[model samples]
Target: MPDLPILLIVVVGIALVFDFTNGAHDSANAIATIVSTKVLSPLTAVLMAGALNLLGAFLGESVAHTIGSGIVQPEMVAGSQGLVLAALLGAIFWNLLTWYLGIPSSSSHALIGGLIGAAVAYGGWDAPLYGSIGAKVIVPLLLSPLAGFLSGYLLMVLLSWLVVRSTPGRVNFLFKKLQIVSSAFMATSHGLNDAQKTMGIITLALFTFHEIPEMAVPFWVKLACALAMGLGTASGGWKIVKTMGHKIFKLEPIHGFAAETAAAAVICTASAMGAPISTTHTISTTVIGVGASKRLSAVRWGVAGRLVVAWVLTIPAAALVSALCYWFLAVTGLAV
Candidate 1:
């Protein structure tokens, strides 16, 4: 038990590291559209996203609790420092890889997959909370991107038709103003959902070591998670920004507005339900939707296809890495 407290501290640190990576990896979601459309400078977009993301932390905590306790059994997580470390390492490595590749993969899924992989490696069939896991993790993963795609597509078509006769200059002027409002919503949704993943992991670590009561997420922890992600977003991930903003599609102000609005809505909906979906997936798919509205050829299916491959691989890759880390630690006698 004495060792458990020390291990818990280590896991908390790892969780924050994961949170930081999450921000860097997913910052593309918040800034891509605005930057792509030239509605905002990259620097300005990131700063806005970071600030609103921090502000968003104050919005809610339901999602945080679900991630901390709803995924796996606390009793099993107890005395499992090796497992936690493995899971974190797995997710971290994947984030770095995808970030470098300019693929906006699912940070949320990577973390969840890492945990599942680590738990399965260590616990086999005894991994806790599979039923809830399916409902919360897998179901949302499938639906969020699709929801973003449809929403963005529909919104863009409607907006385009409504302003069909308007001058391009006037349309740009109006959406430029509207982008600020929608971007805030997107950033806020980001904080409400993405920040909660870290909060959950931290809370889970605390509960694993018996530092908290009944796996509850505390106010202070929520603030810290939000701050970590916001800070990381402020620091920025320029490589991904370039890819998301320029490579996938040619975007204008209206496209940016539609994509951001759609992404924000999907993310916020998932957050309110305590479900953690990938902000990366949601925004990327939305961007595609906007681009596709122009024509199939306009969307650059090649780049997007590669991104899809990365998204599909994220969970298993992180999970495998975490499992390997767990095995190495266990065999080396670092975790018992």
Candidate 2:
């Protein structure tokens, strides 16, 4: 095995890289609606989203705690730093692949899947806490999108009824202004839920290296992950943004406001509960819900079908990659 200090550095660096890609890939979740609706220019929207994402990262550590010790058994993989490295590599690979293909897949699931796969590879079937994952991770992953869809559909209906007597021009003008606030809220929630995944991974690595006595995320770890997420958000992701902003549904400013507001609410709640739900899934489904509320035909189900396929495949696919990565690392005598 390489020097402990050097391996720890490499693992932490890869973890940060994963965090950066996460922000870039998922940036569309926060800004796509506002950008598509022309409520904010792309530059202004990403800038605001990036800054708000940073602030959101500082809001809570519950999700971070969940990520660090809830999914995989920390003691089982403590000395095997390569397992953590492989997990991050798997997640980063999936993030880049989905970004290139313009699919709004779940980075949150990818990370969880990677950890599960790498843990299993390192210590067999007993390595991961399946019950904890089912209770905390899978349950929230399934329910958050459902909650977003229902909230968005109901909210859009309410907004439409409230504006029933108003002219279309007046409604559009009013929502255009309101969408900006909704978009900011969406961005903050995105950071709150997403950035903490990296914080947890880093804390896991610190524990693995005995750099920290427990699984708690240090202040420096939180700050570094937040900054990486913020910078990645600033870089923007146009490919996925095009898919999210225009393909699944044609979003008017009112629809954008409804989708962002509903998604943000669901995401923030999940973060508080220490559930690492996908902001991408929440916003995408909310957009679908808002469009369906307008008319069933308003949403392009074909595009949504493709997104669902990608979403369903994210966890298993990332797990396979991480498992392969762990095997290679072990075979190469890097699994210290």
Candidate 3:
């Protein structure tokens, strides 16, 4: 086995790598609608999203605190740094696979699943703080998407009613401009929720190594994660972008504006509450809801069904992989 300091360095590097993959994988959540609606060119949209994502990362550390200490027990993590490595490997593997397949699964869930699986593998089933996981992670995981869908549907309906007397050309022209603000709001919220997950992971590792007296995130850790996520967002994930922007439903400027507005509101609220909800799930369901407000058949149920399947499987699949990773590390005598 390598020295502890060296291993600690490797774990931090991998955590940042996972953060980068997270940004690339979930960038579509921030910009897909605006791109699909032609409100902004793809290049312009990603650049803007990347900048806002960086800015939003500086907003708060509540989500980071939850991630660092809310799910796993600190005592178990104190010496078992290898388990954290396995968890990150599991998440990165899942994120890449889903990105290649153009599935916008939740990176947030993938990380949480990886942590749960690795913790169980290393320290038994009782290692995790089940109550915290149930309340902070699971409840938010289940409810945020529902909130997004209902909000999107209701908001779209309200918008349609308001514009009923307006000309189609007038509505399109008005919303095209408004969608830009909504898109920026969505991107900022995405950064706030998503970048903090990496911050929490790195801080957890530092706490494990006794480098930090407590689980508080250091400023450097936050800055590094924010930059990694921003660069990854700039690199873009075009395949998932196609799936998110065009596969579930065809979006016009009005629909894009409504969906972004609803999803952003849900995400920002979750961030404030320190719930690491999936921006992907929130945005996807909002798109569907916005479309459904038009009619039942307006949404491509077949595509939406595939997304649901991926969502349901993400936790278990990533968990299984992380468990296997932990098992391998243990067998190799590398998990201390």
TM-score of every prediction relative to native: 0.96, 0.99, 0.99
As for candidate 3, its clashing pairs are none
lDDT of 2: 0.93
After superposition, candidate 1 runs with Cα above 4 Å error: none
Q: Could you list the CA RMSD of all candidates, in the order they appear?
A: 1.5, 0.7, 0.8
Q: How far is candidate 2 from the true structure (C-alpha RMSD, Å)?
A: 0.7
Question: Candidate 3, overall lDDT?
Answer: 0.93
Q: In candidate 3, what are the lDDT values of residues 42-78, reduced to their tens digit?
A: 9999999999999999999999998899989987778
Candidate 1: count of backbone clashes, pairs at least 3 residues apart or interchain: 0
Evaluate residue 202 in candidate 3 and report its C-alpha lDDT on the 0 to 100 scale: 92
CA lDDT of each candidate?
A: 0.85, 0.93, 0.93
Q: Worst lDDT window (10 residues) for model 2?
A: 75-84
Q: What TM-score, to 2 decimals, does candidate 3 have?
A: 0.99
Candidate 2 residue lDDT tens string, 65-172: 999999999988887879889999899999999999999999999999999999998899999999999989889878887898899999999999999999999999
Candidate 1 residues 36-107, lDDT tens each? 778788789899999888988778887887777777777877767677778888999999898877778888
lDDT of 3 at 39: 90
